[model samples]
Target chain A: MPQRYAYLGPQGTFTEAAMRSFPGADEAEHLPYATVPAALDALRRAEVDLAVVALENSVEGSVPTTLDELATGEPLQIVGEAHLPVSFALLVRPGTDLGDIKTVASHPHAQPQCRRWLAENVPHAEWRAATSNAEAAQHVADGHYDAALAGSFAAARYGLSVLAEDIHDVADAVTRFIALRRPGTPPPPTGTDRTTVVAFIGEDHPGALLEILTEFSMRGINLTLIQSRPTGAGLGSYLFWIELEGHVDDARVGEALMGLRRVCADVRFVGSYPRADQVRPEIRRGTHDQDFTEAAAWLASVRSGHA
Target chain B: MPQRYAYLGPQGTFTEAAMRSFPGADEAEHLPYATVPAALDALRRAEVDLAVVALENSVEGSVPTTLDELATGEPLQIVGEAHLPVSFALLVRPGTDLGDIKTVASHPHAQPQCRRWLAENVPHAEWRAATSNAEAAQHVADGHYDAALAGSFAAARYGLSVLAEDIHDVADAVTRFIALRRPGTPPPPTGTDRTTVVAFIGEDHPGALLEILTEFSMRGINLTLIQSRPTGAGLGSYLFWIELEGHVDDARVGEALMGLRRVCADVRFVGSYPRADQVRPEIRRGTHDQDFTEAAAWLASVRSGHA
Candidate 1:
């Protein structure tokens, strides 16, 4: 049987495009889920071999549902990641004209991306929401709505016309999606990788976060992203979500995690996976696998007090 | 003449409620805008003396619209903040029964907050979007929809009956709203205060952030919130939003800001304002005005090489 993979769908959504871009995905059996949690739950239940869900967007910092779900329940390991450049087109029925477009439909996330274009070109249209951009196009195709803001692929798949192309407010919008599997050993470090973790402060005290950062700073680790989400206990309580450069297999990263565990109430390891960004700075001159091995040998020799 | 104020509305929305809670708000002229940017733009244009906008929600983290507006264009300073406990109620036309409700209308934000309740109680209801929660109730009252998820105030304002009460998914959900005025001197320190600033890393060096945090860690500053937003230029670039204890008037905080200015490409000060959380641990044991004054005098005496 072909390996089963799940993605948020009703087909032709950006997520489906991302899943299709994965290696060997064309040969895999694809399953569609109505929501992010549903797809993740299917993976957890072993209904599929892998799952893909959007984690963050360049325009919208993080997807709250994805973040909250990953923070709780049975832990899921992120095995890989994909970056998709997003561009939305104004989709409408074949004979629909600009003046005939009265109600614009799309997923809530898609609306804001084309706010400027909508305001400038079609200022009088009423905004309507749908489950997905493809669903929005499907509605337009079915005459449920006059127009929609969706992917070009969605327009093609749903048999809708591209009334206007590349209408997103930002030209370089990108969304980062993660591939997840049931908790297990992460992929081997690829020299260019990112490790994600959630840290709960041991106590609400002044300088608590400083201590957490100190561990990584002293080890020469670089943070790619950091965000704080409320713990749901109260207004002031929060859990820090951090993404840093390095893999758990790296000695410096392993030491930092150990130090964090000692200082935090609990540290939830999301996973270490190859970073999605294609452009990255060259690895630091002095820090790599061979350098760490040499340093470890030097420390061992000095411990005998015979250097 | 009364001072004019603007908030996200068509009236009866939570933003309006938060605006009304501001001191002396009743005496001010209230203007309702259809969106957050509209209200802030009105303030920038001098159409309003102040603007009130939702900043963060306990469950949703930061509002991207508000954060991006604050980070760009002509800067607006946050003068005050309000904490409103959010509780959604199901509003329906008089004599409408639960089984009779086939469609539920609400603002997108309200819909998600009651997702669990709706899924459990009214599993078959089709969700519809409205301009605002109050507007949702208004539609239901006008016989356009069967029910809405809105605040109790909205139900009363729209002359609708509450069919179900307190339907929010999280019991402790609260939204933090900030009062903004044209860039000016911030309000004086309240002994308990927070200073917010946005920092752009000068160079994408390995430990650029560590250098920025060191300035605060050495001074024992406690960070209340921290988030990174893309600069919109491309994928890897980001602007860090930071909220830390101490007013800008406080010596340590002022010094930290100065230090950040030296290291960062640019630092934008959002404002120094009193926090919204009602219960707070007494400001750190000895970091108040008296201690700072005494320490200054002691340093002067010791500089003479005599005590």
Candidate 2:
């Protein structure tokens, strides 16, 4: 059966770029929505078989709207994850000199990626907000702009020339995307794997949070990230977002999570997935210098529980 | 010495409403920034002695910008929390009929609260995004739109008339605001209190989440709410936002938090403040209604766990 997937798109959205990495692309249908919530709705109503949504960007934090929908909407299992290495470009109408431009337009997320370049080179240009990077390119085509900070794909798709390539401050700017479906048994692990989960608990008092962390630590389990949102139930209560190393079926993993349940008033398991490969040539072979010192230090500390 | 303060302002913003509740209001020197990050930066640079920022809203989840800043920036202590009830109105030009309004403009957060009302009453109107509610009101005053959805205070401030009051589908809508400052000894707690904390960890696994929750349940500590965000690390770690009853000094709380620290790799205590009275009127000598039901349920549940 053909699978229909919805993403934030006109084309060239980092989400669109990530969604392209899905396996068996020929059999999957693709659709674009203006906002994350709209994409989730289409998935909820069975309008689509799968939804590829941008969960987080390396420079920015989690996309809250997507996270909120996941927290409150019907349970959806995250069947797959992708880490798309993002490289940004400054796109402009052909023959327009960079110095002649007086304004730059792009989505909020893209603006930050190009901040340093804009600050140093085009500091005085007005920064305008558009719905998406692709939309920003379309705006450049539809009207006059000094230029736009967008993706390489967006520039090509809109037929705009890349005035400057890879203008982002970080060479390894990547976005992590997730594919969600109605809850089902996780597909058999193919070599490498990762799992995701969500939970709600108290935030106030002294020992409440520590108790949850100790369970994994005691068993040598590692946690990836933890996020929270207000439950609108006054103070002291929150909706917690958590991810840890290993699969749910791993003996120690199951034991540790069950232990967390005993201490948290309420806990929910979102889903587990395969950790995306990090050494793809497209991601690692860019012209940028390969400096992993800071990343290595941070990861080592985290792996050692000292971070 | 007069303290420096920051609030979401331009006047008529819900943040302004929340900031009004702070102590030393008359003596504090105030600065208004267009966004939460701007204000948070002012605090981080020590340009301001304190900042009052909106963390969450009843209709929306955690403000991602606020949580992200707290997660990444210099250490900040959550000194207090407050709940400000939000009631919205539909304001229009003096002579415009409600049916004739073609567009409704407002800050993005205000859109959800008025969604149902707008859907049913003015289904065809397009929604415009504005910088703030007061700005939306000013837009209407300038006749850019036939109407706008805004707070009554905004309308009054901008000299617009309310075409309809309490137009939000949820009557008791409210926002949770957090008062933040550099780490300092909070004034001693009065009897009524709550504590908030954020936890970050380095693993991404399934039951790994439950392990963290068990700490609170075993000690009979009642949790209020939990929310999570990715920490922008490649390891897939999360920053968990949690709330719970009791204060830092309580024996049970101290023990529970100690237990949790063993589980979470990194944890920061965001705040512990007097649990402001919940959203229901303290003395609504009237028939049993929805607010009564909600408030009663909240109080009963907390009292049950404390017992």
Error of 2 at B111 (Å): 84
Q: Give candidate 1's TM-score.
A: 0.50
Q: Per-model C-alpha lDDT, please? A: 0.81, 0.72
TM-score of model 2 (CA atoms): 0.46
- After superposition, the stretches of candidate 1 with alpha carbons farther than 4 Å from their true spots are A234-236, A281-286, B1-307
Per residue, candidate 2 scores C-alpha lDDT tens digits across A62-134 of 8888777787777677878899776678889888887878889999888878888898987788999988888
| TM-score of every model versus the real structure | 0.50, 0.46
Clashes of 1: 0
Please give the lDDT score for candidate 1: 0.81
Residue-wise C-alpha lDDT for candidate 2, range B43-62, written one tens digit per residue: 88899988888888887878
Task: Give DockQ per model, in order.
Answer: 0.01, 0.01
- Clashing residue pairs in candidate 1 are none
Over B25-134, each residue of candidate 1 has an lDDT whose tens digit, in order, gives 99999999998999999999999999999999988889999998998657888888998887888999888899999999999888778888999999999999998888
